[model samples]
Target chain A: AQSVTQLDSHVSVSEGTPVLLRCNYSSSYSPSLFWYVQHPNKGLQLLLKYTSAATLVKGINGFEAEFKKSETSFHLTKPSAHMSDAAEYFCVVSAFGGNRDDKIIFGKGTRLHILP
Target chain B: GAGVSQSPRYKVAKRGQDVALRCDPISGHVSLFWYQQALGQGPEFLTYFQNEAQLDKSGLPSDRFFAERPEGSVSTLKIQRTQQEDSAVYLCASSSPREWGQPQHFGDGTRLSIL
Candidate 1:
């Protein structure tokens, strides 16, 4: 049984400011983690993923997440926030690092709000 | 052909009505998934299909919920009797066979409202 937890239901930041959305996971096996962004009335877009590779992962739009084994965390970050960055973000844990298990679990979500 | 496409972006139904939702996965994609998302919540897996084989249906809420991918290309989810609790966005996603870690591409989703 794998699961994900998003620390914040919502996070607000000013334009040009750095952003952080925290996530944690629990898996019996090595996990495959992912970040997805969903805009209003739009489909989800992949941000990044970590599958027992490099701890630091870079994604589109300058977004990135670091997989911390000690902390059981994969937190998304950005150096500067843009208005287009306002969207709902999800952290997911795919069972067994995706080689065998395709079952995925999602967090409730973190709604990012960019203030002008 | 550009991406996964779902029919009728929105649907409204009365109690006891049967509704069917369609999903067209990416050309030659091997895996397809169906999920239901409530307001302000992440999508919940309902079922999965590998080609035309329905591999997993464990997440389905009840027997009233059913899904099928007959020709290994298109799939359908049918709700036998609409209920207020069924009012939510139904999302469809598909992934290819290149990598196990490949993220699934999603459709905009169909917002089903039961009245």
Candidate 2:
């Protein structure tokens, strides 16, 4: 079984302030973790993915996430939040092995709101 | 040609009516997937196809849902007799040819409303 949890349902940040969206995962095998952002009525855009690569993975738009295995966490962070960063974010987990039944699991999501 | 595309951006169907959602994956991408996303909820996997092969459909809620990728390019997800509970955003995604750790490219999705 594989699952992910977004610790916060909604997060509010002021533009130019730091932002943090926490996520945790549960999996039986080594997993691939990802962060994705979706604007209103838009498809999911990949932010970053951790596939046993560098623990701290940087993504586009000044966003990054650190994969902490000991804590079973993959938390997305932005040094400075922008108005455009206000959107819903999802944490996802995929299996590392090629199991015929492997399925990716998504977190409930955290909606970010930015204030100028 | 640039990204995955889905048809019927929005559909409103009466209860018990059938609906079909179309998805066109990136050309030559072998892995395609369908998902259901309820309001404020994360998208849930419904099915996956590798080429024309329907490799996984266990996540589908019931037999009311059926999916086909006839020629390994375009796919359709048909809902037989939709219920109010069937209202959700149907998302389609495609990744490269691989079994694991492939980042999927997603479509804008088709919003279905069962009234």
Candidate 3:
């Protein structure tokens, strides 16, 4: 019953401009949220994770996402976009159904296009 | 070598042919997962294994899709009677058992193409 929705299917931004990718989730339990990036023909790389520790979580490569409980949103952001930032971004949610059921649900994904 | 590894980076077969994909998890990872990713779509869960126990296989699309983690380390996903709909990138990921909220490490994936 847990699901994640990415607001945009594609986002275009100029180099040196700020970037934003919006995501929302519906979960019955306190969720563990994550952001992952995948390049063409490459595996998905974890960006950041929120495990009930901090609302604001920082990730690799100058990326960050904030977990808003009231709004049920975990949107990813970057201070400035770079040419290398072009990739597919996914928002994930895990219900934490004990140790046996750690399956994570993924959003449809938003493709980021950085223009030079 | 340090991350999850999947074999046969690309596979092409006839519609009726059977294909097998392999995955080798990290040295000590206790949880392994298989996912199917169609073009322009997010990965969908297929099955999961905790050590050698196949705990969940509910996400499997049909009986033709089967997966197993035999020795708690190596896993294989076999698709019998492959069809055009089964052509997708099959991804394998592993995570540690120590924490329920741990992030998963992924493989580059095996791209299966059914002709």
Candidate 4:
């Protein structure tokens, strides 16, 4: 079984300040983790993905997330928040089923609000 | 044009009515996925297809939901006898191949409002 948990439903950060959105996961197999952002009325855009290669994954728009196996966490972060960064972020985990079918699980989501 | 495309950006249908939504995935992509997203929520997987083969439909909510990708290039999701709870944004995504750590490209999605 695979599951993702986004710790915060909403996070408000002041412009020019740092931002953080926490996420945790549980997977019986080696998981493929991802962070995706969705602006209003827009499609989901992949921020980054964590394969086994590197623990620190950098994404578009100056965002990045570090995969911590010991903590079972993949928290997204940014050095400074921008007004355009306001959006909903989802944490996802993908694993193979017993039949080898890909099964992806998504978190409830964390809404980021940038305060100017 | 290079990314996935979904039809009927917004659709309004009466309860008990049937509706169909379409998805056109990226060219040469071997994997396609359908998901249902509710208000202020992350997407929930509905089904997956590897080319024209419907390998998984376990996430489908009910029998009223059906999906097909006959030719492997395009896909359609049909809902029979829709209900109020069925109102959601149906999202479609595609990936290059069935590989570990493959990121999916998504379409804008179809907002279906059941009246």
The C-alpha lDDT values of all candidates are: 0.92, 0.94, 0.94, 0.94
Model 2 spans > 4 angstroms off: A98-102
Minimal lDDT window, size 10, model 3 chain B: B96-105
lDDT of 1 by residue, A1-116 (tens): 78899999999999999999999999988888999999999888999999888999999999999999999999999999999999999999887543337778889999999999
- Per-residue lDDT, model 3, residue A104, is 90
Best by DockQ: 2
Q: What TM-score would each prediction reach against the true structure?
A: 0.97, 0.97, 0.98, 0.98
Q: Per-residue lDDT of B1-115 in model 1, one digit per residue for the tens?
A: 5899998899999989999999998998999999999988999999999999998899899999999999999999999988999999999999997465778889999999999
lDDT by residue (A13-114, candidate 3, tens digit) is 999999999999998778999999999999999999999998999999999999999899999999999999999999999887654348899999999999
Clashing pairs in 1: none
**Displacement of the residue B79 alpha carbon in candidate 2, Å:** 0.4
Compared with the true structure, what per-residue lDDT tens digits does model 2 show for residues A1-116? 78899999999999999999999999888999999999999999999999897999999999999999999999999999999999999999997654643479999999999999
Q: Per-residue lDDT tens digits of candidate 3, residues B3-114?
A: 9999999999999999999999999999899999999999999999999999899889999999988789999999999999999999999998748579999999999999
Residue pairs with colliding backbones in model 4 are: none
For candidate 1, the per-residue lDDT at B106 reads: 91
Clashes of each: 0, 0, 0, 0
The TM-score of candidate 2 is 0.97
Weakest ten-residue segment in model 1 chain B by summed lDDT? B97-106
Compared with the true structure, the alpha-carbon lDDT of candidate 3 equals 0.94
Which residue runs of candidate 3 sit more than 4 Å off their true CA positions? A98-100
- What tens digits encode model 2's per-residue C-alpha lDDT throughout B19-90? 999999999899999999999999999999999999999989999999999999999999998999999999
